[model samples]
Target chain A: MSNTDLEDDLRGTFDRAAASVPMATDLTGRATTDARRAQRRTWMISAAAAVAVASIAAATFGLSGGRSTPVQLPVAGGNAPASTSAVETEPSVETVSGTWRPVQMAGLKALSAERPEDPVLVFRPDGTWTGSDGCNGLQGTYNIGQRGEFTAKAGMQRLIGCDNVPHTGVLQSAKRIAVDASTLEFYGADGRELARYARAR
Target chain B: MEFEEYVSARGQDLVRLGFTVSGDYQRAEDLAQIALMQAFRSWRKVRKADDPHLYVRRILVNAYLSMTRRRSFTESPSAEIDPPHPVPDPATDIVNSDDLWRALAELSARERVVLVLRYYQDLDDRTIADMLGIKPSSVRSTASRALATLRKARQSHHVS
Candidate 1:
């Protein structure tokens, strides 16, 4: 027989053979659900990995300090001295080293007044930090004293012009740092609150 | 088009194509699902393509080849003979349905794949070559060799 005739015969045979295979009724729904599940699984794995890395860095850099040593702080009205015991009870900078979103800024609000984009600050356990202030990228190294005092020395700042916010000033003037649960507070050298940020989950 | 709409429309055709390629419903479903999931993941890019269906078909073919490669390394040798094909009904227009299917099954995976794409899907040599990542000349030779094998199988069946 000719090749065309043979091909026709094979096509007929293939059709009949394939006809016996039943159609999958809910294949679309199953596939859609499976795809969504796979996407969720991927997101969950990525989030877990981020948390794991943050935790590992926190541990490696001694970001989490034991509460055995309590630091003293003078009271306002010459009353009993306030102790860091209360602050140490919760997760402070030592336990919270990750990306944080600015919730409130005190001194440098004018720069972020027009368009208040949530400024992101990332604290690395290696005494390094990097983030964006809705305008320019900020990168620098930081030092945390035993009393949870944070001192940051600016390293590099991009001079991109943006009308939203300029976080360079706050980040540069930040001297004291405190963490309460998911909230983080940055203080200037004058002991006034510079910026308050919430941990980005 | 939305990914869900695409899946709803072309999903069955893909499953059928998978069935034709694998010759097993379960494996076909797996291959279709895997390809569809991959398509869904890259829907933004895939939907913008000139032919989304063709793009998905390429993914299905790749997935099937990958699955077969993995199966080859993992599956243990079986000494038992394969089950006999069902007896063909004389009333059927196709006289040797069982023998044909059995013959097709006996061919190597690549040979069967080329035959199915050419005859069943009615795809051209260039399209088949593009899908299988082979040259058009290779497709012609493979189809020629596959047809020769089928003819040999038919003759052997007649003698037996």
Candidate 2:
């Protein structure tokens, strides 16, 4: 009947509800294991990215009209090498604008379609993107700056329940993209590689 | 304190809060895990804050809100329909408590959240607003509407 009565009733009801539900089991154990796995994934990604970049640089150096000196490529936590006359390559609009298939996602090294369908992503030149997480349909808009800075905003998505569906978490976290002739790599805001995709055949 | 120690101390409370907000134990556990994982990822930064527990609370609330919003966009229309309300006997305190629980569940997610944060967590409208990313006035209005709904539900139970 009164405000105090209402507040008391609410508190009583909530307290009862809270008491009825049991505390989550193994929450700490699960959380710690997940955290450690995530940490390992980050380290692996960093190492893979460094190797990928080195290989790309070495290939580019060999194709640079046979330059006499090899320009040292960047390594993880290593000092910057001396600059050379060979022009550094960057992914252009043509390289980035197309459909891609996930080679790796969600911190997993390989994503095999458990079902008949595989996840696909379409990054349109008009700054819009659409994809299937192998089950649910997802659409979003994206932006690409002059220096390969990238960002994506998710739009409508279906709520179909399916297992092993590739998550968009990595794409959402991507801050930059690097595209070579066949593969594209997405880097997080912290400059760590998040996911890698290959051109769809 | 270390992250594992913090989890041992306050993890149950976070999960309980999640259950209160979501009204589903499985989802509550999922929400709590997501928040805890996020907190674990940034434990260093979170621990340095004035109240690291508060930071985790904010994350849990935000995650619950985000999940609800996404569900709203894609949830089937048939799922939103509530069952017919049953008349409660004012003579029975047990019946009255059941009515109260029903009334609480009838409230919208945002309304329930406002009440849960206000009554359950004893947070002010300003703090709730900050957590929900809404204006303080909006928080007040939401709470006002929620309380009004609860009162009306109680009054109807007594009338019948």
lDDT of 2 by residue, A1-201 (tens): 987898888887777777777757788888878867866765565455445553544455456643434323322223642222132235444556788888754335337747445688887753468878877887875655556656566777777765544446655566567666667777654454556787784
**Superposition TM-score, candidate 1 onto the true structure:** 0.54
Chain B TM-scores per candidate, in order, are 0.85, 0.84
Deviating ranges (above 4 Å) for candidate 2: A38-201, B72-94
Mind listing the fnat for each candidate?
0.54, 0.64
- Model 2 clash pairs? none
Interface RMSD of each: 3.0, 3.0
Kindly give the stretch of ten consecutive residues in candidate 1 chain A with the minimal lDDT sum.
A66-75
Best by TM-score: 2
> Candidate 1 — which residues are off by over 4 angstroms?
A51-201, B72-89, B92-95
Instruction: Assign candidate 2 its CAPRI class.
Output: acceptable
The sequence of per-residue lDDT tens digits that candidate 2 reaches over residues B85-160 is 4554443554565567778777888998889999999999998998888999999999989999999999998898
Q: Which TM-score value belongs to model 2?
A: 0.58
